[model samples]
Target: MISGVASESSSQLLPWQQPIWQDLVRRQQQSGLPHALMFTGIAGIGKHELSLRVAHWLLCQNSSGQADGLTESCGHCHSCQLWQAGSHPDFMVCQPEDNSRQIRIDSIRKVNEFLAQTPQISRCQVVVIRPVEVMNTNAANALLKTLEEPAGESFLLLEAERFGSVLPTIRSRCQRIQLLAPSAEQAQQWLQASGVSPDQASQALRYNPQAPLQAQLWLEHNLGEQQQQWLDLFGQWTQGRAPLDKVVAAYTKMELDDVIHWYAGVLADALKLTLSVAEDQLLHGGWLAQLLNACGDGATLNKTKLITLQRNVQEIQGGLLSGAAHHNKQLLNESLLLQWRALLQ
Candidate 1:
């Protein structure tokens, strides 16, 4: 659905899909093409999908190898069909396994072997590596030799979250194609086109369309429901009679890492209340006056909220919360809730 051939059932292509596809089509249409291309960008930005689309285009038998005689393997031909099914003997896609972020040398060796042999079908052998920077030393070494020549017609599509972390030798041999997220407006539009409500689409843009699903789920599930629970607890805490320990325990059970985020949501409501008698509606404008009153009636809450955001970003950058998610991912679930309470206080 991205830049390459789109079928009737293909998923809706995001805003960032067209540029890379068009570039490749143009170059291949013109002359001898880049065999090894490094598609570099942020994680979850659809780089993997982009790589597959290019592979499909390259191996499509229906394609008459472009206008250039230099182009090979027609897109609609038999070789292309095999590539589509991922049954093509010469094509390979490599990546790190679950629980490990680094690509082992063994994986690289396998890729090398796949490329070393002559292409059984198409003239070119396509090897795609996702998150190329995940290659460990031995893996890098194993791939380095193959990358140098990569055989004419051998196309390597390597995707990495960031470019700087990859080996210079590995990068030097390949052409780099940078992929970026579409504009915020574009992301919202894409989601709307996909049938999501405008409100949900707008909410998902908070993080990045690269991860719109994450933003959508967070807002719809966690923030929408759990956030209300938190607001109730916040109210009880402000009442003076509620034991701070019990309230703290409830907060400890809540899932929130960015304490500043939670605070700001409430803090904004407090400000809105003061400026215009918007009435009690803090935290979705519910009990706004109560929240403003709870904050002790001042602009100080805004300043505190901003400071909290700054501090949270710093600590997160330092991996201060790394231990929170260590051991089991669910293990961190508890730790995250506990830490959120402590951090906010």
Candidate 2:
């Protein structure tokens, strides 16, 4: 429970947390409304919150479905009360119920049942599904069937990480709204206020609020195990004896998403070693120095090689989007390190 706030239900959100509230309000007020909406963004970015607010708007007795542009739910209204209490029969929120880390068919089946009914307050019934792409084969099919036919005035809201992973059919049926990361300065101030130390604040803020700023702060402030994830790869990539297991295990910890950070630290150090940059204040100066000794670059790293590192980072984002792993992660990392090795050669 954040201070001075209600239970912080997924629908009520900080203004900066989501930038599209007014746009949503405008549509609600203007009476242009969709039967289904898809919200996509990083975790903790108020996807759930925004969806709830939309549900409230739909259920609001006074709402004409115009985008009021007020960017808020009427807290005094009956719809808002039911939503704030999470007791609205016409309102449903679904997420993975299984401890198995997947949103299974049974949960979505329940959503189908909920949508089949009429709204208690108004003609509109709102259903929200978080991490919606987790729907397995059968679940996705069940949802596809609903999308094909008319289902009264129900509005289905889904929040997913990889929007493309959702069935193309489902994507076609719903309008999508994307939320992005906060600015660096904004993120930095948020992290610091949350108690992150000055040394760790800068790196921690590089990722947006929804990207686990607090977790990154914890990792950076403490002498935690960042090396274990990549040390084996670093060792074997140099000797060319690196087993697939070493690379895979390292990647499982670091993941393709995190590759750029490692490169950012290492490459920044190489710049200093080459005298291209002053030594006083590298972000990861200590870690940078250590990687340089291991990778062996005297001064400015191979500019040609740094380009390859940049490319590898891009590929990681691509791999996540394409749902491809292993080969892509391995090829990207090993390929970049091989470029680094060439400088030593």
lDDT of 2 by residue, 136-244 (tens): 6777788887766647888888888788778787889888888775666666666667677765666444322345444454455442356444644665665556765
lDDT of 2: 0.63
Q: What is the lDDT of residue 229 in candidate 1?
A: 76
Question: Best candidate, lDDT-wise?
Answer: 2
Q: What is the lDDT of every predicted structure here?
A: 0.61, 0.63
Give candidate 2 regions above 4 Å deviation: 1-6, 17-19, 60-71, 121-123, 192-200, 207-345
Lowest-scoring 10 consecutive residues by lDDT in candidate 2? 1-10
Taking all chains together, the TM-score of candidate 2 against the true structure is 0.63
lDDT of 1 by residue, 1-345 (tens): 001233312222345788767667778877746888998876556677777767756665555456743232344567766654547766677877654556788778777777778877767777788778767778888888887877556888999766987889889988999888667766667667767788877655543345554455565565656666776776665544465666666655654454435655555554455456444333354475554456563412344544554454445432322222223324433443343334222
Clash number for each model: 20, 17
Candidate number with greatest TM-score: 1
lDDT score, candidate 2, position 287: 50
